[model samples]
Target: MKLQCEVEVINRMLPTFGMRNRGKGTRAVLSVGRQEGKRGAIYLMICTLKDKAGSRYKLENNIEQLFTKFLGEGKATIRLKEPALDICLSKAEMCSLKNFVSIVGLANKGSDAGTPLLSQLIPAKTSEIEKPRAKMFITSKKDYPITKNFPYSLEQLQVSYCKLARIDMRMLCLKKLQKLDLSNNHIKKLPKTIGDLICLQELILSHNYLESFEVALCNSTLSNSLKLLDLSENKIKALPVQICNFKELISLKIDENDLLQLPFTIGRLSKLRLISAAKNKLSCLPSTFKMLRLEKVDLFGNPFIQASPMVPDIQLKIPQTLLETAAREVARYRIPYGPQLIPATLCQDLSMAKTCDCGLSCLNSFIQIVVAMNLHQVSQTVVLVDTMGGTDAPIICYFCSLTCYSHFLDKYLQSIRD
Candidate 1:
């Protein structure tokens, strides 16, 4: 197999000395095949970018061991014996890397298994066409590449200070993009097409004019890949309840917005660790605020309600409707009911099912109450919620049944009295 990738020849058995300390590799091509006219002998050849007569080694008895060490995405190190050399391959396409490694591994076994088909030894045409046209594109001078040579293979693209009122359609076509920064623009709305960037991990829309976090974005493939989202300095009044779909989100910054309250389901984001929502107009947190295990939480400058005496208002409708009972069962057991199995309205209602303190799911028939929560209990590093050195904030709670409410009332009252 022939693959074009970076190559590094390092002998760790040799002492670290002059000229070896740089530890950088060169762009090269690796080839694995049988030597011409040499029956039953496999050869591994590496050609540097500038040389054609590359170093060749006979695989029979020349290799003591062969194994692969993953460095990171798109990079790997192959260790070979006898010469005690490590061949590091960086910036290699994943498909090419896998094929190259497999061929060399089979050759090292010293059998006819080393003889890969003749066609398999040739580089794939698709790999040549998929070669990156560009890896990164950044601009802050308002010189956007809207019509010309837009980097199609870009993994990172920053188009800040461009005054772009809408997302560029060309950018959504970059399926390999990992980070997209459109900060300091005038964008008012995000295109649902933004979700086409299935590989995107960081999305920065700070200093924009956005008014709402669309549900389409939350339901997209981004729910799986997005790790960091910065929506700071926007005019958003409320985030969609579906924001909980960002299961992989780690850091969320919504500072200087007009948010009233976060989604009650946000606690479902099990990977979330950091949050910055300072200077918002939030009065109370969702009931599930205490469910988070956060590392850092910043709520300074927000108007959080002071702690009040616990009040229980038990309001439950007994003998729930057949639909409500079925919905609760589906939600509690996660029966995988979707729009295809039921009406769209019922599916929507089921998606919004509430969870009681007792861990059971409920719909419209539940008792509700309000209580104070100390922010310190939810996070390790917390900024004060108000100027009065207060950290207590009100959180709404729901109970699926009177039995669940009765069971929690004693512990809840005793804790609040403390």
Candidate 2:
């Protein structure tokens, strides 16, 4: 009888199981019957119970089962108020309605969904329900001492945005912590015992007032596990040479700092891929920097001077020889009160001069006479002249008799031409 009833219920629910109009309270029943001479009837219902009392009782029993299996023998309440049978399952003399719906579409014709349902139905094993891990937060007010005694057993800790004046992290005993974030804080220094976090993988100390890096971080164990480290926006001028000891470090950011130079040990970071040292006071790079297997480098705002022993072609094209020769000639013959004379060694030309003489006779006679004769030589009576064929040739002078003769020749030539 129970088998017949289960078959009938399954058939009824099968056609409408996947249908939209089957309604929420529709039940899918599975019943088993005695093969020979069994007396009692058994029925199994698998669906939501509309009766509040019956639904409550089933929920409470399931909760009890869950606690006993997962929480190590715990007690639970069981009571139900209403019943508008949705899905039913029957086996021998047992019958129960299941409220939870499996998202995977029901397969009445096969046993594909049964294994998954049974697995989920079995409560978690006792060994699986371990104590929950704790969490840590930085809630200290500004200017307060950052206490190290955290309240929770944390696997990860985030202490950002806490305006802490001083950090005493030595008191922290977080052995299980795997990650720590101290970004955007007012931390000036890290405790020397920071290496205590043997299990830590990622540590972020960006945007802080750290004037120097923690020396304790040089520990080989910590460096091996530390994969990412960010120390950007700080007052750090130089990184410790031990930084290259981080054999496992992949990414490092030290941007917006006062770094003047990087240690050559940077080449030891064989696994380093990304590095940022922008906005620094770096004037030159280390030769070992070529050893870096970098994809990109930001070297802006650095003073670079490209120098070579050989003069450039552009400088060779300039008329430097002519300029030097003219400068030298002018310097050798210091002509005063006429075409303001420039020294030969000077690279530029002179334009004007300030006369010291005040009298008109001094200006007209002396200045004019000097200007007309091009008398560059200063002597007692007669000015000397360079009568040499070439402009740069030696200077020479003739007596007053020769000067009169030169005047006679100039007059004779002019008369003949007219």
Candidate 3:
């Protein structure tokens, strides 16, 4: 809603509070607009010069304080701050935190321009005082409202570290959007509708609770123009082979995930220039990795018992690329040596208990069924499965193995054909 900080520099994004000429002790104003046309309140700060020898670095310290304060406020005109970060800060830092914006319930007034903040510049209501004040509010930046006009001609939308968990499809219908960043949110899943952004080029959904990539359901255009895809620091365990469809990808980041493997077609990304799979559980790379047109790669902190000792030697250097390239040429015609394979019989330990006649109970992973189905119904149909009423009419069959389930399901489908 509002912020106070010491100004160390005069810049366009940050106003000098008309005190840039005042030098060292002047406060700076950072006024961010919500809508494209409207102006918002400015962040004012009183600069204190403890040591003026070098204060530019100290200006960044103010930015840090600004960040810490927004996170401290439980709610604000905009929501920011990760709750997990609070654990590491000391008591005094938390104590120094204060939310600048305020939230006022105005049922009679419109929700958008309903509550105008009262500060030094503007001290009255819109009806009583017609002066133009900054359109600002104190609300959860995480829960920041998305108006229909917010995405008008918008090309990039970044909500990183905003504590946001989901994309508002209504606001995401913008036709011009090229990039979307939702990093550092606690989001558990991505809306398949994200594929609807026909012009999207970059998708940064890093550092969240996402466990897997829903490749088949996403839109076709998403992969057509995408160049940078950062899914690093998520809970991804395995990626679908369809990810190779992102032929335009220049960089891919899947680091710090639970991933033990990548699709064999990963190397099919002919345009991929860089890939970072650091801090994952990968034991070996895909056999197709030899086909990658990569310029750089990072694969540190993995378990590769039978892997080539060259793993530790996989440093970022031109010579290493040449060496790997030469080796890749030799291995191109040979069978891929990476990505360990497990026999079907070894899949017995895992099972998915179910209530349907589709014989899905013995399946090992949802992706298996997702691959069979169109892949867009999981989120929509989960509720129906809970509310279905016809289950009382049947005698259920439980299969001991995936093969048995597949056999039964196939037989049942064939029987229906008769």
lDDT tens digits, residue span 249-349, model 1: 99999999999998878888888999999999988788777889999999888877653335666666677888778878888787987778889998889
Residues 42-61, model 2: lDDT tens digits: 11222222311111112211
Clashes of each: 0, 31, 12
Please report how far candidate 2 places residue 117 from its true position, in Å.
Answer: 44
Q: Which of the two candidates, 2 or 3, achieves a greater lDDT against the reference?
A: 3
The residue ranges of model 3 lying beyond 4 angstroms of the native Cα positions read: 1-143, 146-149, 217-219, 308-418
- TM-scores of the models, in the order given: 0.67, 0.40, 0.41
For model 3, how does the per-residue alpha-carbon lDDT over 212-248 read when each residue is reduced to its tens digit?
8887533377788889999999999998877877878
Model 1 regions lying over 4 Å from their true place: 1-139, 307-315, 332-336, 415-418
Tell how far residue 282 is off in model 3, in angstroms.
0.3
| Decoy 1 TM-score against native | 0.67
State the RMSD for candidate 2: 29.8
Model 2 / residue 355 / CA error / Å:
66
Task: Go through the candidates in order and give each one's C-alpha lDDT.
Answer: 0.79, 0.44, 0.48
Off by over 4 Å in 2: 1-131, 134-152, 168-171, 303-418
